[model samples]
Structures are given as C-alpha cells and as structure tokens.
Target: MVVNVSNLSPRLRQLGLVAVLFGAIPAGLALMGGGYPFQVGITALIFVTLAVSLNLVTGTAGLLSLGHAGFFGVGAYAAALAATKLHWPFLLTLPLAGIVAAALGVIVALPTMRLISIYFAVATLGVGEMIHVSLLNWVSFTRGPMGIRSIPPIEILGLDLSGVIGGYYVAATVAALAIFAVHRLTHSYYGNALRSLREDDQCSAAMGLNPVRLKIEAFAVSCAIAGMAGAVYAHTASFISPDSFRFEESILILAMIVVGGLGSLPGAVIGAVLLIVLPEVLRGIGDFRMIAVGVFMFLSILFLPKGLLGEASAIGLARRQLGAAWRGDIGAGWK
Candidate 1:
C-alpha cells in the first residue's frame, strides 16, 4: 500500500516519509543485487545527527560555530576512554560521551555566548583549535595524534555487531532519536525564544528573553548531539583521534546545515549525505575527484541555493513529475 504523505505537519510528514522510504531502500538494493547497502545508508544517519546538531546553533540560535569538531572530538574521545580504558559498557559510554560534550559546551558557551556573527564564529574557531591542540598535547587523555584505535563495537544485550548491516541499524536508531529530539525542541517555547534571538537579539532581550541562557542552552544541546554522533562514529570506525575531528569536520557539518536550508532537519540529512557520501561517488574520477566535489559544492550553493534537496523540492511541484523527477526533488527547500 502506498503510504500517505503530502498533508501531515511538516515535521511529522518529513519524519514519516523518511521512515517509509528508508525501510524500502535496503530491500530494493538487495533486489537489485547490492550487498550490505544499508551500511552506506547508516553512515548517512550518523552524519545527519552531526549536521542537525549543528543546525541548532546555525539555524535556530543564529550563531555560527567554526569549531564544532571540538565537541565531536570530545564525544568520540570520551567514548574511547570509557570503553577501552575505564572498561565501561558500550551502552553506558554512549550517553556519557554526550554528557562530557555537554559539560564542555557549557564551559565554552559561558565565555562565548556574548559574541555574535563573525565574532562568534571566530571565538568558536579559537575554542575548536584549543580542543584539537589539547587532544594532541594531552597525550594522557587523547593518546595524542596516534589516536585511540581498536574501539569496541556496540553490544546490544551481549550481541556484538558483526557487520556493517548492524551498524546501519544502530546509526539509524541514534539518528532517528536525535531527529525526534530536535523536532520536539524546535517546536517548544524555548525553540521560539531561540528563533526570536536568531532574528534579532535586542528585540528578543527586550521581550525579556535571556539570550545568554538560551544561547548557552542551544550550544550545550547542539554539542551533546555532536558528541553522540561522534561516539557512534568511534564505534563504527573502530578508531579515534584528534585528526579525525579537525576543523574540516566542523566545516563539513556547518556546510550540511547551511546548505540544507538552515533551520530544517530534513535539510540537514540531505546536505550531510550529499556532502559525505557523494564524495565517494566521485572518487572514481581520480585526481579530479576533489575538483569535482569543489565544483559540485559550488554549483550546489549557486544553483541549488538552499541545498541539493532544497533545489529538488522546487523542481517537484508538477503533477507530471514522478519517480525520477521526484528523486530530483529537494523537499528540504524552505523559503
């Protein structure tokens, strides 16, 4: 039976539509003779989590952070420390990583919350660099540039994930949870406060909203989600280090949110997948791969404007457009 879409609330419609399509992709891929297709699909989930988390600041709070990689690193390292050294359960370590990142976020936000726009981005850049340098110099914590390898895989009820397929499920579940949480938050009164602040801080404050608390809360929550994604990544890659969560990583997440139509969750996912996995699709181009990516990204920013999905949505308005055309439709478009 065809699932009903096109009339639900924006968030509900988006989430349900995604759920329906996601369940079918694996079976279709299998029917088409693809192996372990869910693995790539799962990676998209993890990346989406990172992007949406970044969306909180860039989208809702109107704060541009150039150093989100710092929080992502914090989460991965925390998970590494807990699972490998402390011998904690994988389940136990997952939330702990988020907590660690949240704590760090609070500390960083307290100092930088007063800044905005370019100054805010610059301040976060410094904070991110400090995190990266700390990971390198504080060998005892991060194990230095060598990074923490041999990360333990997730074990659910004592069943260890033996392949990428299982990883897809785990990543998808985490990503779904993050999506729901973000959706709930965005619809809440606090989310309204954030949007108000994003539009105009002085007006938001004049109405008696505490920009500092709201900004700090948004930063803290965003960092926590980044940390959660990082922890998931550590397990998926079975490794960790300062190098993996560098400035580029932060920029990639920022691009995901920015290009995906800013404050939209579905936009975040679409942007992440295009930026993260599409690179693999271009890898066969050899030396031109990076160049193609640059060009594609440039074109996406120029032509797509909001993002690939955003552009696709604009093209999807015609009743004659179905299937292939729909695939080209970027529903992530807003405004």
Candidate 2:
C-alpha cells in the first residue's frame, strides 16, 4: 500500500499534522536552553537530515548504498576548504558542499548503473573506502589525519551562530527544510516514478519510466542533501575529519533508516532520534552498551520485519480489519 497523506482520512491527516508540529516542541525547548542536552539536540537534528536524505535512495528508489558517508565527507571537506582557503562565507559554502557532493554522487552512479542489489551495495562500500583513503592520503588538501581545525562557525546577516542556541536553531531549521523538500518530492509524479522503479525497475521502464535516469537523479538529490547536512555539522562542531565520516557512520545511518521504517518519512526522523539518543541513554551500561544495542536491533528485526513504520505490516492489519468488518465481527471495532 502506497501511503500518501492525501489518501488518508481528514481526521488522520489533521492528527498527523498536529503530531508533527508538537514534535518540534521538545527540540525547541532543548535549543532554548544551552547545555549537553542542547548539544545532543543539534547532533540529533543533523542525523535526522542525513537519514531523510538517505531515504531518497534507500527507501524511495530501493538503492542500498553503503557509502553515503563518502558524499557526506566530500561536503564537509568542501565547506572546510571554502572557509579556510577561499575565505568564502558560510552561506556560499553550504551550496558549494552540496554541489561537490552531488558531483561525486553522479560519478558513483554512472559506474553502478548496470548493477543492482548486492552488487550495487558492494560497489558503494568500495566507493566509501576509496573516499576514506583519499581523505587520509590527500594531506595538503584535507590536512590528512590531523583534520580541519579552527573552522569558523556559521554567520549570516551580521549574526554569529557559534553559540549552542544559535547552532541548534540552525540545525533544526535545516532539518525541517530537508524534510519539507523530501515530502514535496515524494508526493510528486517524480516520486511515484522512483517508487515504481523500486518496486520493479523493468516493469517501470516498460511503462515508459526511465529507471537509470530516475535512479541517478535520486542518488544525486539524496547525496546533495547529505552534503548540506555535512556542511551544517562542520560549522556547528567547528571541526571535521575523515574518521567522522567512515564506514561505521554509514552503517549507523543505514540502521536509522531500517529501524525507523524503510520508505517512511516520519520513520527517518524517528529512527534518527531513537538511534542517536539510544547510545547516550545507554551510557550507564559501560562495557555492555553495544551488546544491549545489538540485542535490541536483533529483536526489532525479528518482530517488526518491515521496520517500525513500514507499510507492509500496516497493510496486513488493515486487510484483517476490513475482512472482520465484512463478516460482522463487532469485537474487531470496525463500524
């Protein structure tokens, strides 16, 4: 079942909107007060943006990329270089990072167009490793292992956003914008084309949709959004290195999309918040923290096979309810 907001009942639509608006309150409060909690909020917003961007390819286009961190790193480096070397303003660097990352996405997409499923995934993993090595080896450009330092914080229109409060606001605003953009994209005809490609590329192509073009476009858009998030992260933290955007980071992001519910927008946000906050919440566990995390994920997969927000199981429940209604099963609660 394709779950479009327009297809939902008016009451459900209003409820969803209310829930979305209310969800912003906690983050806003955290930002209003600066502290460790505020810091965590900033990081959560960044991950939220990344998760949404990754969903474009992984969820909508059904492309499992294991190297999204490569594009993310590219964006961070691009922003850093522009700020440190070219002395560009923060505003300019944001788009520059996205453009550079999108270019890399195109490069990656071209070679992997003929591949799909596991083959495509493996190729992306290799691409991520290549980026990591390049960042480590390209000393003069990326400053090698020492990473970029003293990177200036975001400033716009005579306002400096280096403070925790300002940083959180910026991160939240960017994340909100990213979510809105994805929502618009996913509701359009183009989104349907991507979904069709995900369901069956050959069949979509037979119906006159161009799978290759759609896939490449999705990848470019997704990576570009990731790059924007990276730029925000670099400016907010005022430091970035290749280690920050490694294979493990990619895996964590993949986990966010999966645990949140693949192909669900709200799922991206939920997954980002849950996973990013989960580690912090588990800090008391000390040596066994990761074990707990692994066990939790195992159980989630075992139970919510399609993910927490995935439609497959929801559709099943809906069908059961309708069937019960047809048979006059009053206890089923269907009027």
What is the lDDT, from 0 to 100, of the residue 190 in candidate 1?
72
lDDT string, candidate 2, 282-317, tens digits: 999888888887787788889987788884543343
Stretch of 10 with least lDDT, candidate 1: 317-326
Tens digits of per-residue lDDT for model 1 on 204-277? 89999999998999999999999998888888878877888789888888887767777766688778888777
State each model's CA lDDT, in order: 0.79, 0.83
Clashing residue pairs for model 1? 309-330, 312-329, 312-330, 313-329, 313-330
Candidate 1: residue 321 lDDT (0-100) = 23
71 Cα displacement, candidate 2 (Å): 0.8
Whole-model alpha-carbon lDDT for candidate 1: 0.79
Displacement of the residue 248 alpha carbon in candidate 1, Å: 0.8
Residue 204 displacement (Å), model 1: 0.6
